[model samples]
Target chain A: MFGLRYLEDVVTLELDASKCTGCGNCIEVCPHAVFEIFEKKARIVDRDACMECGACAMNCAPGALSVDSGVGCASAVITGAVRGTEPTCGCSEDADCC
Target chain B: MNESTRNTGECCQGSSTQKPVEQAREQQECTCQPEEAPHWSDGSIDTPSGRILRVKTTLTPRDHLGTWMVHWGIRRMRYKITPGLYAVGSPTQQSPVFVTANYKMSFDRLRSQLWGRHAWILVLDTKGVNVWCSAGKGTFGSEELMRRIQAVRLEEIVSHRTLILPQLSATGVSAHIVRKGNGWRVVFGPVRSEDLPRYLDAGMKATPQMRCVRFTLANRLVLIPLECVEWFKYLVLASVVFLLLSGFGTGGYSLERIQDVGLRSVLMLLIAYLAGAAFSPALLPWIPGRAFSVKGAWIGLAAVVVLIAYGLPGPGVFDNWLEAGGWLLLVPAISSFLAMNFTGASTYTSLSGVRREMRVAVPSQITATAAGIVVWVVGRFM
Candidate 1:
C-alpha cells in the first residue's frame, strides 16, 4: 500500500475530531490512502492522495466523514445534467445532440 | 466498417479517455489483434522490454498524411481529440515551436490543422495522455513541462523562447514557474486548434470566445456516451433486478412486465444524466443557482414536470406511476451525482465548495432515490 502521505491531488475530507465518532470507516473506505486510524479515530494521514471520490464519507454512518467527491470531468457532468437522460456520445445512435 | 477491420483499426488506435495505464494496455492490444495496422513488417513494433507499441498503421492517400483519416474520423466521431504535444513539421532554429501531449488525437489535430504550415511539435511525455487530463494529473504541470522541454532540447530547435500551449492547460502548469524553471515563456493559445492560425496571426492573443469555456448543447451531447457506457453495466444489472422484482410484485414471474424495468430505467437514467450532464451545461447560466447540485436539482424537477405532462397515462396508470416515481428521485439524485462530478471540471469550484455540496447533497440523493424506489414498489403492489 502507498503510504498515507501519497496525496497526488487535493482532497475534500477533513476530520473534525470534535465531530468524529472514531468509527474508522473513513480509513477503511478510502480508495486513496488518505486516512489513518489513531486513538480509535480516523485522521487524515494524507490529504494529497485523496481523489475526492467521496466513498469514505458516503459510507460513514455517523456523518463524521465529509468530502467534495464526484467525477471530475466537466464534459461528462455537463452532458449528464442537460439531456434529462444520460449524456450520449457524439455517436450515440443519432440523437439530435449526438 | 467491417467488424474485424474496425476492431483492428480501433485497437491500433488510441483515445484521450484512456488513462496512461489503460492506454498502454490498449496499445499492446493494437499489435496483438489481427489485421492491426499493417504498416510494419508483421504489423507490430516489439520493443526490447516486451512492450508493444503499434507504430504501424495502414497507409492512406496523401490528402492527409499516413492514417490521419482514422485520426480525423475518430476526432469527428468523438468530438474530443486526444491531448498531447506533437510535431506538425520538423523545425530548425528560427522555426515556430508548439507544445502538446502524447494524446495521439490532440497531436493529430494540431498537426492536421497546421496542414501546410512548417513547425516543430514538441511532444511532452505526458505518458501518452491528453493535455487536460495530464494537467489534472500534474503531467502538464511545471515540472513535467520543464522536464519535457529539457528532454526535447527544445531550446536548440527554436530561436524563440516562447512555447505555445493549449489554453486549458493553464490550471496545472503555472506559466511563471515554467518560465522560471526552463528559461522559456509559456503562451496559452486557443482551446481549439482551428483557431491556432488566427491566434498566431493576431500575435498570440486569444479572442474572448476562445478564452471562454463553452458548455454548449453540442459539447454536452458528445460527452453523453462515455457516461452511458459506464452505466451500461450497472444499467443491465439494475434492469434485471428491477424486472425480476416487478414481476414478482405485479405479474407473478413474467417477462412482459419485466421489459418495463428496462424502459423505466433507461428513461429515468437518461433524464437524470441528460439534465445533469447535457442540459445543465447547456443552460448553466439560467439553471437558477450557482451550486451545481442545486442547478441539477432544478433541472431534475423540470424533467419530472416535462415527463409527467408528456409520458404519464392517467392518474391511476400503474406503469406511468412507476416511471414517475422512478424519475422523481432518479432525476434529482442523478443531477446531484452529475453536479458532484463537476467539481473537477469547473474553474470556480473550490475544495470547500465541493465538500460542502457533497455533505448536503449525498444524503438527499440517497433519500430521493430510496424514496422513488419505494414508491415504485408500493405502486406495483397496490
Candidate 2:
C-alpha cells in the first residue's frame, strides 16, 4: 500500500459510529487496515485505503458499514455499461474473469 | 434413462421418494472425481468418510507448464480441479483442513506449500475461478462452504470444527454466520499461500503483514503477458487497416507510400502498446499519477518523443508536420486506454476510484483518437 495508493477521497466507504458494536470485524476483514477501534467504536482511520470490497459490511452484525461495492476493473465497468448489467468480471470462456 | 440418471431426474421433479435423491447426491458429492479424468489426484487413501483422493505436495512439470500457459491466456478458464476434499500427505482426523477454490493454480499453490506436511484440502466449486475473484462474485460464499461441508459430511471426517480460509475470501464468506449457523469456526489465513507454513507454526495467528495484500514488482510483471495477449490481435488488425488506408493519396493509390508510411505506423503502434501494457505497469510507482490512464499517457508521450527524435514516418510523408502531429495525439490515447485496463489487476484501486477516473479519461481518449484519425487521414490526402 505504501507505493500502490490510488485516487484520494474516492472510496465510498462510510461508517455510522453509533451502529458500530466495536466487534472489530471491519479491522479483521479489511486487507488495507482502513479501520481501527477508538473508544470502543469502529473508526475509519485511512479512508482512502478502503477498496470497498463489502467484506467488512457483510461480516458486520450491526450493519455499521456501508459502501457501493463492486469490482474495481475498468473493463468490467465498460462491459457492464455496454451490456446494461451490474459490473461483472468477464465470465466468457476465453477471458480469464478477473 | 439409466437408474441413477432417472433417479436424479425424479429428484428434480419433486418425487415423493426423496430419501434416494438425498443418498444419490451424497454419493456423488463423496466421490467428486470426474468419470473421464483420473489425473485429478496422484493417488487414493482410505478414510472414515470414504476413499479420498491423495494429492502430492510437489507439483509436476505439467503443472508448471499449465501455470505458464494460463499467464498467456491459454486454456485459462478451464484450468480447474475437481471440487471436493483432497488429502495432502497422510492427513488424519486431527489434521488441518484448508479451504480453497477449485482453480488448479490456487489448488497447486496451496498443496505445493504443504511439502512433508499432512493436511486436508477442501476445494469449493468456483467454476475454475480463483479464490479472491470468485469470493468477490459470491461463488465462494458462506452458502457454498456450508453446502460443501454438509455434502462431504465433514463433521464425520474431521475431529475438529475449525476451517482455515484464505483471508481474501472474506469478501464472500461471513465468518460469524458460518460459526453461528453450523458451529464451524472460520479462521482466516494469510493473503498468500506461500506464507501458510509460518501461519500454521504460529498457531494460526496471522501478523499484519500477512493480512495485507501487496502488488509487488514480480506480481505486476507476471500479469504483463496476459495484457500483451489480450491486445495482440487488435494491434495486428489495426495495423493492416492502417496499411490499406495509407494507399490512398491525392495523386493516386501508391504501394510505395503505403510501404513506407503504413509500415512506420505499425512500428509506432507496437511501441505505444509496449509503453502502455509493459512499461507503464513495470514503472507504475514511479509514474506520476494516481490514475492508470495518466501514467500510461506519460509513458506514451515519452515513447512518441523518442520516435519523433528517431525520425518516424520517414521524409517522404505527404505532410511531415500533419503526420507527426496526428501520432503525438494518437499514441498516448491508445496507451492510456490500455493502461486503464490494468485497474482490474491492481490490488488497491476502489470501484469508485476507477469509475471516477474512467468517467473523465475515457471521453478524453475517445476525442483524442477521433481527432488524431481525422488529422492523419487529412495528411494522407495532402
Candidate 3:
C-alpha cells in the first residue's frame, strides 16, 4: 500500500462499459480507488494502482468487471511451483505455506 | 542479557500483563465451546432454527483488548467468535441478513457500526481469519456460505430472499452458484463496514469512495509491530552469529574484543531490521523506488551512512578497512531482503509483479550477502 508503484501495464483488471449498469459497486469495493463513474459508466481511472484483489469484479452485478486475481506472496508462489499446484494464499487447511 | 530476561522483555509489555500463549489458549477455548449457549445479551430470542443471541452494537473494553492483542500477534489465530446467527437489535422475520467472517474483529467492527439498526448477522466459520483473507483462501466461499445457511436455517428465520456479503469476499463466492442453488440473491456490500449504513440507506447501492481501499499512514504503521515480532527470532540468530564472527577478525577472543564486537554487531542488526521491516513499510511511498527491494536498500544505505558518520567501529579492533567495508555491504543487503518480504503483506503488489521483482532482486541479494561474507572472512585471515 506504500506509494511505490510497480510495472504500470501489468495489471489484469478489465471493465466492460457497455455491460456496466453504473451501479457504482466496483467503485465501492475497490480498495485501490481504481474506478470512476463518468457518463453513467464505470471507467478505470487509476489502472496502475490496481492490486487485483478481484473485489470489484465480484461485486459487479451486471458481469461488467473481470480480473485475474491470486495471492501476491512470493513464498507461496515458490511453494506452489515446487509442489506443482496452483498457488494459494496459504490460508487453506492442506497447505502451511504461511 | 540472558535467555530468561530477554524472553520476559520480549513477551511482556505495558498492558500485556497476561502471557501471549496463555491468552491464545484462552481464546481457543472460548471459540471451541459448544454453540448451545450463545455469548450474547439477556434479551436473546429463540427462533424456529436456533437461538439468536442479541449483542451490543458498541465495543467493550474486552473487545478493545482483543484487538490490541491481535495487533501485537497474540492470540491472533484463536481470535474468533462462534459461527451462527446473531441479532443486533429487535429484528423480526423480515430484517436484512448480513454475512461476515467469524473473526471477532470483523464481527465486532460490523456490529459496532450498526448501533441503532436492527439486523441479522450471519457469521461464517473462517477459522479466525478476517473476511478478505478468508475469502481469498476459499474458506469464505460458496460452499461454506451454503453450509452455514443450511445449518442456521436462515430461510426459516428471515422472510427475505437476499443475503448481503462483504465486497472483498467476492473472490471465493460465485453469486450465480449461490443464487441457482438456494434461490437466494447475493448483494455485495461496501469494502468497509462503516459504509454499510450509507449503503443500506441508499437502497443497498454503494458510492465510489466506499469501494476504494486506502492504506493510510496509520494503517501501514499498525502492521509493523507484528512484522517486528515475527522476525525477532531471526534477528537474534543473526546478531549472535555476527557477534561471534566479529571476534575472528582480531585473531583471538578477549573481553574487550567480544564486548566491542557484540555491541556493534547487535546495533547493526537492529538498524538493518528497523530499516527494512519497520521503516520500509511505514515510509513506503516516500522511498524512491517502484521495487520493494530497492526501497529497502535505500533505507539500508541510510543506516550505513549513519553508522559511518558515527565512526565505523574503530581500527583498534580490526586489521584494516576490509571488515568495515564488508559490513557496509552486508547490513543493507539484509535490510533489502527483509523489506522484500513485506511485499506479501502490502496492498500494491500483484502476483505477477512480485514474481518479476523476485527474479531480479533475490539473486542480487544473495550475491551481495555472499560476497560480503567472503570479504569479511578474507579480512579476518589477513
Q: Give candidate 2 regions above 4 Å deviation.
A: A92-98, B1-40, B311-319
**lDDT tens readout by residue for model 3, A1-98:** 34657656878888888899998766766777888889998999999888877777766778899898876665556566876976554442311111
Cand. 1 Cα-lDDT: 0.55
Model 1 CA deviation exceeding 4 Å by range: A1-98, B1-90, B250-287, B303-316, B319-327, B339-351
- The DockQ for candidate 2, computed on C-alphas, is 0.42
Worst 10 residues of 2 chain B by lDDT: B1-10
What is the per-residue lDDT of model 1 for residues B1-382, given as tens digits with 9 covering 90 to 100?
0000011123345575766455544443332224443222122222222322222122224424423433323333322222222334333466677777655556656665665565666655454445655554455666666765554445654578988887656545666566666678776777777788888888877665665444445654445444444445655675566656666455466666667654555566666766776676556566666556777898888877776767445622235666566667777887767755654544334344554566677788888988887887776665
Per-residue lDDT of B183 in model 3: 86
* Top lDDT prediction, candidate number: 2
Per-model i-RMS? 15.6, 9.9, 9.7
Write the residue-wise lDDT of candidate 2 on B291-326 in tens digits: 999999989988777766776556233247777778
lDDT of 2 at A59: 86
Candidate 1: TM-score?
Answer: 0.58
- TM-scores, each model vs. reference: 0.58, 0.90, 0.84
Better model by TM-score, 1 or 2?
Answer: 2
Interface RMSD of 3: 9.7
lDDT of each: 0.55, 0.82, 0.75
Q: Name the top DockQ candidate.
A: 2
